[model samples]
Target: MRTGAAATYDPFASYADPREPLFTSTVVSVIGNIGMGKSTCMKCLFVLRPLLLGRRVVVLDKKRQGAEGEYGPIARAMGTQPVRLVPGGGPGASCINLIDPRIGIATSSGAATSEGRPAGQLELVQRVIAEYLGHSLDVLGIEALRVALLAAPGRAAADSREPTLLDLIWCLQHPHDGQVRSLYDDSWTAADVYGWGREAAATLLVLANGELGGVIDGPTSPEVSVDHPAGLTVFDISSLPNSGPALGIVMLLIQTWLSGLLAQRSAARQQTILVVEEGWHVSSSASLGEMFREQAKLSRALGLCLVAGFHHPSDLPHGSPARALMKESSTLFLFGQSEEVEVRETLSIAQLPRELGDLIRSLPQGECVLVKAGADPEHVSIGISDWEAAVTNTDAQLTGDAYG
Candidate 1:
């Protein structure tokens, strides 16, 4: 089994043997409270073995602080502007083709097995519905999406042209059309089918053409593409209206795009990094969480590393995608948390000794407990250069704000 070295040197600075493998796999989970420097620590870790190993980094930056994003400066330092995904429908506003062929999608007959391999097109549509609705789809919704996903692709002239969410919505709303009518089994009438379609896919229809501003309902934007060099590409979705589940949807789409890109580049055998800040968004739902879990499970095979950041232990409870990731993580960083209950719970879930709860609660800024799969867990004060601190600090953008 080929394993990517976790760190070139001892990250805890214990002066241990340089040849010892600190961790295995490429998944790292950073758990901490707000202002505890989770991102800062991750920035330091990202530079260690991943960069030194010639891995490309792609960050799903959800925070929109400036024209760039949370990791904008770092991306710029590597010579690329963050891709701005904004709402309001104007020039400079970006759009993503959610069904882009490069994004992985399995056909109904070719679905991934229970072992968490990539899903087929039908499964991808079902997962998208779950993320969009922030819950599992009912029976009717699942069948509706499945039929649409299966039928629409066959209806398109070019096999390479993937069906859009709008096309699926249309399929649901108009099942009587010759193309989609055959999807209906002996189970229902035209009225029954149409009514179910309205109930099952109405929100998606609205998101595609109504309140969500069709950000995800079209062909690939010639203005925006994911073809970048082997460095960081940050998708800044902060400017989108914050009223709904836009962040989760955007993150899912980004992951899909990256998965497809990696699928195409598999022959290169180059390792890649995928960082999802505010990982709670992806962990909140079963489908989104499972999607992430499957990706982490397949990271080694895909030659990728996933770094997920979360603010609270509760963000990843039992059965959560984040919790599954925690269990499979090769490297773990736990920063300070003021809540005792949270500290204890984190330690318990992570299988650390109960006595460490106090230490976790009392940890100061820039310090954290580092746990590697193959190395002893230890507290490390992360050292950051002045430049790294400037770019990595989340509060740097808020320093000049004042109440009017």
Candidate 2:
């Protein structure tokens, strides 16, 4: 109440000048081995009251769904409902549920018939893959391609998995030619390539006409929580016998939509984040490469934000697309990674200068380093526990229980 001789005026009263620059908004990846809290970070970021966020958000979890309830607590804490859409096809079929009046759940592919398929979708995909193999066909010949396609990974390669189309395609494209000199002679490789190519072609024809599903981007509802909001989507690929067949289609739709959205804004810097988890399946798809290439080059102009989170970059076939994603990325968050090779690969990116490497490696779980491409990088570790409060009261239980 008392003013001294040199009292300073309140900064709030100085309305003429803005205190902060607009954040160059982004959609970035937070990667770690398994339980490093990537999903939790998302919950912390968007699972808030609608009032705080001028816009609503959408989240898609590829591996786990138990944590989904956090959305409810977060939404409720913010005086809003958390709407969750868990499509069918995993251990259970798709079902929609509402966490509260504010949050609604719409599950696509739930009770989806394996019979209904849009004509021409698969035919279009096979043509695309054939064109890609043509690139390697010119470089490595065919034998190496066949061996790569048929060969299995080190048992530790994945958590109880089989040879996926993307894995084979990646091998064909980025052959381990230098690593295995004795496996094939000139003629053997040629025959192998021919056989695998034919098989891939056949699979494409079958798959294109088969029972696969994809997410339709939505913010479709007119009323706030009553309809799909303009934000995020979870195109869960678990239901398919294998993710490889569906990868390209999912990426195609997402990228096409993102590119179109970006193009419409004549002179804006807004970014749409494509949070693609299990991106290995996507990157390996020969048909999806072109879409990714476009996003890496022009996403920001369209104000697009992209975040690719997968078990490891190695699963991504080779390096290029993931490398490109890393280069275009404004921020990268690495969580507790279990694989050493992938950890080293990410460390190479996350830890640039020699001095920063130690600090980066030593950081604990949940916390991550933020590197804004051209600027100096900084490490900020945030700690988070499971948002049980969100889940216990979620529509997820309703859906899961109903399915059970």
* Candidate achieving the largest lDDT: 1
**Global Cα lDDT for candidate 2:** 0.41
Candidate 2 RMSD to the correct structure? 16.2
Model 1: lDDT to the true structure: 0.64
Clashes of each: 3, 31
lDDT of 2 by residue, 226-338 (tens): 22343433334433323343445444433433333344332343323444554344434655545555665655455444556655655544455665566445556656555
Distance (Å) between predicted and true CA of 306, model 1? 1.6
Off by over 4 Å in 2: 1-27, 46-52, 55-61, 64-209, 213-227, 241-244, 257-271, 278-284, 314-319, 337-340, 383-404
Question: What are the per-residue Cα lDDT tens digits for candidate 1 across 205-234?
Answer: 656665345567766554245566535667
Residue clash pairs of candidate 1 = 106-120, 106-121, 107-121
Off by over 4 Å in 1: 1-24, 47-53, 64-69, 87-91, 104-205, 218-226, 239-251, 279-284, 401-404
